[model samples]
Target: MKRTILVLSLAFCSLAATAADTSKGAESTAPTCPVTGKAANPAITLVYEGNSYAFADETAKQKFSDDRANSLYQKLGGKTAIDAAVELFYVKVLADKRVNHFFEDINMNKQKRKQKEFLSAALGGPIPYAGKDLRSAHESLGGLNDSHFDAIAENLLATLTELKVDPQLIEQAMAIVGSTRDAVLNRPAKPATPAVP
Candidate 1:
């Protein structure tokens, strides 16, 4: 029992260190109380998605808890759910012919970790993503087109479906992901055409 506890302690320390490393030198932003817009009391901390978020007081903490409980992230089972979905999502991505080529020289472990962070924050997880913006990250992927993007999106939808996620939630997630298309594509938005005068 002592050995098991020690092992778990080491594993947890490793994970916390890794998260700190990913922050890449910048200190974590101090959380503000959402209700009062004041600096949070460090003692009133709540752990979410493996990170601690401080609240100004017990009341502020309660409000944040209430809001998070109804969030899509919470609805989808928080970090564990997002992590599983991203892992499965990438397995599908790498096996797909249309997208697999782009990842041939990539470090898949790092890629998977980054993807998890990106998706979690995008889906309203408590932690903010610390990776490159979408445009800069994909700018070097030559010959990427709408078809390739579609292939990626399709695999994501299929993966979510196979996981038996709620269809409405899946749709909402897709819509949010889809909104990143222009940035991911590394292009300026096409100007809207004016109506005929």
Candidate 2:
């Protein structure tokens, strides 16, 4: 009778330990995102259209984030080059009579800082953007059309050239600006009326 009771107690302890192990393993292996849900590429989708997403692998995600940050820092002339580029850009924009009106109500100092943050983040630098999204911020500007975009792009090109940035890198940066065309021109500019003949 004593031997049978000891055997029964050992069996129960073993079962309890096995159950605990299984629960722990399940917790560790659980999926971060559901298998049937949307993908995790934020840039590919429109601003507010997608469901929530998660990185498929934590380690890979960290690597990607780090690479982006480093690339942006290098692309924007590093820490020192950013200030020069920003200054040049503003100067060029201010000198252009056609687009100066758009910037008339802006606080130039604040805008310079915001542009720095934007470039840093977009190029994968370590800075977090404090500025509003392009569409919302520019929506109130009347007559912001493709011509305005072209003027901005031209000014940016001239600024980058003055900063001695590589032509290829400048091209790459300009490509980013082109991507925001749709967002920046959210509304059509009103056409000017023709004089009677």
Candidate 3:
């Protein structure tokens, strides 16, 4: 289960990098409190990762701050760690035959930077991801399939493991990454089965 999540997260991270778009510049006009999901108090705002977030109250502000402080992005050592992982991941990917073709014509430096941003956002970093959604981006790949996705995930898992990231944290990050599978493949989301009591 844990391995699966890490792989998926890594796969999603790579996809995020190649096709992401820029987000709006930092603004003070957040419409809701990310912590409580309530209307924001314009006066109770904070800027993080180049974006502005507002809170309903002091408690909400603190809660949001604490969450960011404890996020997987923070746990993985922030930008430095993320940057190192992306670099290592691409080395493995470029050497792999299964998915390297997809990136054959891509500008890697830009892709690496985008991947960092995507992984940071996916891992609960302070900045929200404003890139083109996964489906649109992956759709442009034309020949993507499960095996390709799995290969990317595997590379990601290996990269994290080699980096000695905590097992539990890798699992958490992977679960988040795995959630993007359907969209990354540009397929329909699987419907949840109804509960049978």
**Highest lDDT scorer:** 3
- Residue 59, candidate 1: C-alpha displacement in angstroms: 4.7
TM-score of each: 0.75, 0.60, 0.71
Q: After superposition, which runs of candidate 2 have C-alpha atoms over 4 Å from their true positions?
A: 1-70, 187-197
| Candidate 1 global lDDT | 0.72
Per-model lDDT: 0.72, 0.59, 0.77
Q: Is candidate 2 or candidate 3 better by TM-score?
A: 3
- Ranking 2 against 3 by lDDT, winner: 3
Cα lDDT for residue 181, candidate 2? 84
Worst 10 residues of 3 by lDDT: 13-22
Better of 1 and 3 by lDDT: 3
Alpha carbon RMSD to native, model 3: 8.1
Best by TM-score: 1
Q: Can you give the lDDT of residue 140 in candidate 3?
A: 85
Which pairs clash in the backbone of model 3?
Answer: 5-174, 6-174, 9-177
lDDT of 2 at 146: 91
Candidate 2 has what TM-score? 0.60
